[model samples]
Each structure stands twice: as structure tokens, then as C-alpha cells.
Target: MEIEGVRTDRLGLLLDQFDQAREMARVRLAGLGDDEYLWEPVPGCWSIRRRDEAVTPRAFGPGEWVLDKGAPDIPASEYAEVVRQAADGMTVAKIADDWSVGVERVEQVLAHTGPPEPDTSPVATIAWRLGHVHSNFEGQWEWTFGERKDPGLLVDFTPSAALALERFWASIDRWRDSVASVTEEQLDTVGFSRYPHSNDAECPYVTVLAGANLEFIHHMAETALLRDLWRTRFTTSG
Candidate 1:
């Protein structure tokens, strides 16, 4: 379809992809119970927890529950800078002063060996995956269609599977509506989506839509696999 001689085929394709992925996620998440949603197949899995029960170094959310993604690690480049500053006769305090960070952070950089040789990201539970999906859509919608406010670290991680499902589905619907409302010119316009969390500001709005669709597809598939594993865990253990 062409609107004022602007082709909307690409936009239609993106919307179709988004709808299909959303339906797949909906079916995969149907009948999810708290036991399966929060199931940790292995020790040290990341998931949603009550703010008081959170064990990760950094947990995010404004409510009683938080999503416990691990804390950010200081990059090796920063550690090298710390080493250079130390070699230049800068005390830890001086280094901290120059960097405008705390002395403990500077010390941590100096003491850091490196990130793990092999990536050791913990397995994420369904709750964590759903929260991530919801946040992505919510943030994208906010920056793209609604107010351009930064969503920041304020995630709404709920312990209830039903509420999580409802929130994510609503988020998807909002994102879909926003995409549908955009014109072809807007789709080709760069910086149409001012989502601060990602590089969407650099890419054309169509690229952002494609990327977001793929993100939903990728994470939802992972969630489905986790559900399958959860269902078979007892048999596998036996």
C-alpha cells in the first residue's frame, strides 16, 4: 500500500512480524502458574524477588518486588586507566578525585582481574524474561509514541505470573498500536524514536521497529524453552 506515494509494504511486514511474535508469546505463556514462572532450574538463577529478599548486588524497581539482574562490572579499559593513574604516582584518593568516582570504585578497578574468560551469565527464570520483555516494550512505547521520558531503572517486577502476563501483553498492544499509527515518512525518518536505553536515536524508525520485533521474538522463544525445561525437569532429574 502506498500513502501519498510512500510505500508502506515494509511497515506492514514489520507490523505482521510483531503481531505474529506477540501471538506466539501469548500462546507460550498461557496457563503459566507462579511455580513455573519463578522456577529456578539451577542454583543462582536470576529472577524477580521481593525487595527485601533480593540477593544480587543491584536490584531494580520501585515497588515491593525487584528484578535481580547482576551489577555492572567495571570494564578492563577502566581498570587499565586506574593502573596507569597508579603508575603515575596518583594515590587511590587522587585517582578517585580525578575520575569523580568513589575511592572504593577506584580500588575495585585496580583490583579487578578481568571478566570471566567464558561468559557465565546466570540462567534467567521466566519471571525475569517476562519482566525484560515488558520493560523493553514499555520503554519503547514511552519514548516513541507517548511522552519521551526516560524509563530508567524503574521496572515493575511482579511476583504474580498472571499480573506479569497481563502487563507484558498490554505493553505489546501499546507498542503495536504505536507502530500502526506511524506514517511511512515517520518510519524512514531518523531519530523518530528517542529511546535512550538503546541506539534507536541513530537509526531510522523502521530499523528500530524491526529490531524491537526481533527482540520480542528472541526473548519469547527463550521463555518458551524455559517453560519446556521446567515441565521436564523432574523427569530429567530422575
Candidate 2:
């Protein structure tokens, strides 16, 4: 079916791009099993655990599931401070060379390493990552475009992989319906979504849509890479 009310080719293209990214996410989710989904390759890794078994110190309110502590991506502002302190204005390239890793690897770690903890690093299990993206995308849609007034309250880090995939696909379906119904004027309007997590208060509605798509793509890629690493580590060991 063709998308309606798309006044410009740009909007049409953006919607198409979102679809492509969503498909990639679906492919990544395929064949994920309960064991692999909740596997923690290392100690102290954040993952979905039973209510009785949950160990993360951070509280995410009353829920059947809890997000393992340590959010992905050290805040950029914090990371900048760390870089200044460690290397004293050295370029990213210098940091990469010093670490004996590729520049991209250095950038990722510098930007995303978990906060300092004693003998424990932040590692997210597949289930946690999936739950995060699903909740984020869905919450944005709910607060920005749907009936929900509070996005933060809508969070759910599902304990099971199957449930996370279900939520994700449901969000995708809602997204397609929402996108199909969007009018040109709505895209042009500012503050279309009152989502407090983003700069939506100052940006055009189209920007929010674009930003959400970027989030989906990157998180999906991260989950895919984790799956590959899991396979490699287990396959080699087995």
C-alpha cells in the first residue's frame, strides 16, 4: 500500500528508510532463543534476570523486569571530560594508537564505556539491549504521537527475548500506521511531540522522526554485533 498525505518526496524517502531499518532489526531478532538472549558472556554483565534473581542495584520502579545497570554510551559530556583528563587534548587518533585498536573501536569505547566500578565492566546481554530499543522507540511514539502523556512511565525491559521481539514488532506496526497518517503540515510543525527526552521542544516534527530512525538503526546494529560475538566466543570454546 502507498503512503498517504506525503506532500514531499523527502518525507516519502524518510519513511522508506525507516522501513528498511526496521526490516534489518527484524532480521537481527530472528532465531534468537531464550538461553542466548539472556546469556552474559562475562561476570557483572547487565541482563534480564528473574525477579528473585535480579541483581542490578539500579531501581527502575515496579515491574516484572529490571534493566541491568549501566546505560550504553557514556554521556558525551562525561566522556569529553575523561579524554581531557587522560590525554590532555590528544586527538582521537592518538588515543586509538595508544590503545592499540582501530580508531573506530577507540571512539566507541571512549563514547560508551560504563562508569567506573570495582572489578566490573558494563556488558549488556542481548535481552537487555532488545528491551531497551523496543521500549525507547515505543515510548517515543507514545509520548510524541500517541495518547501517552508520559514516555518514561511506559518503559518495559522485558525479561524474555520473545516478549521483546513482540513488543518491537508491535511498535513497528504502530509506527507504520502513524507514518501513513502523517500530514505534510504536521511534519512542518514544531513541537509536535512533547517527548522530554529529546530536543523535540525546539525541533520540527520531521527531525524527531528522523532521530528515532537513527536510534533504531544503531541499536539494532549493536544487538547484531553482540550476537556475532556470542557465536564466535561459544563456537570457539565448544
lDDT of each: 0.80, 0.69
Q: Against the true structure, what is each candidate's TM-score? A: 0.75, 0.70
Q: Judged by lDDT, which candidate is best?
A: 1
Which runs in model 2 stand beyond 4 Å of their true positions? 1-8, 50-58, 69-74, 77-121
What is the clash count of model 1? 0
For residues 103-200, write the lDDT of model 2, one tens digit per residue. Answer: 77557756665664343346788887776676667766876678865654565666567777786688778877787678789888888877665546
For model 1, the superposed segments whose C-alpha errors exceed 4 Å read 2-8, 73-119, 153-155, 236-238
Model 1 TM-score? 0.75
lDDT of 1: 0.80
- In Å, residue 236's CA in model 1 sits off its true spot by 4.3
Q: What TM-score quantifies how close candidate 2 is to the native fold? A: 0.70
